[model samples]
Target: MEELILTIVKPLVDYPEDVKILVNEDEGRITYQLSVHKEDMGKVIGKQGRVAKSIRTVVYAAAGSTQQKKVFLEIID
Candidate 1:
């Protein structure tokens, strides 16, 4: 899961080395907190959050239905 996120986001940022993801798993949910370089935040999020939404969509779809827990992606500074 981390690899998937890295693959998707690394290319979009100016500071690829600053990209990081923290995973939190609970009884019924999984959250991926993604943090990127401050300057790259706008690029990852894009205009009106369209890019962020699209990234989340791809991630959720990739997570699939086999998992019992719901998956979530959160972008942070």
Candidate 2:
């Protein structure tokens, strides 16, 4: 899931080289923390959080399909 998100978002940011993704899995859920260069934060999270929402949706779907689990994307600084 993290890889999918990374693949989609890395190219869109100003610092693709600085993009990082961390994934954690619990009993039934998974969370991904995505970090990017500070300068690219605004670009990753577009108007009204639309981009964030889209990323989350993709993570959710990927997890559901691959692991039958619920997944969340946490865009961290």
Candidate 3:
């Protein structure tokens, strides 16, 4: 999962090394917190959050097929 996120985001950022993800699981849910360099925030999020929404959609679809737990992806600074 982390790899998928990295693959998707790293190319869009100026500071690939700054990209990070934190995983938290509780109550049958898994949350992935994705953080990127501040300068790349706009690129990852895109206009009106479309890119973020698209990323989340892909992550959710991928997780739905392979995991029983509800999965979420959050983009953060």
Deviation from truth (RMSD, Å), model 3: 0.6
TM-score of each: 0.95, 0.90, 0.96
Question: How does model 2 fare in lDDT?
Answer: 0.85
Q: What is the number of backbone collisions in each predicted candidate, taken in the order shown?
A: 0, 0, 0
lDDT for 13 in candidate 2 is 93
Give the CA lDDT, 0 to 100, for residue 66 in model 2.
82
Which ten-residue region of model 3 has the weakest summed lDDT? 1-10
Q: Which candidate comes out best when scored by TM-score?
A: 3
Q: Write the per-residue lDDT of candidate 2 for residues 1-77, one digit (tens) a residue.
A: 66788789988997899999888989887778899999999989999999988888877876777876677788899
lDDT of 3 by residue, 1-77 (tens): 88998999899889999999999999999999999989999999999999999999888989999999999999877
Superior candidate under lDDT, 1 versus 2? 1
Off by over 4 Å in 1: none
Q: What would the TM-score be for candidate 1 when compared with the true structure?
A: 0.95
| Candidate that beats the other on TM-score, 1 or 2, i.e. the better one | 1
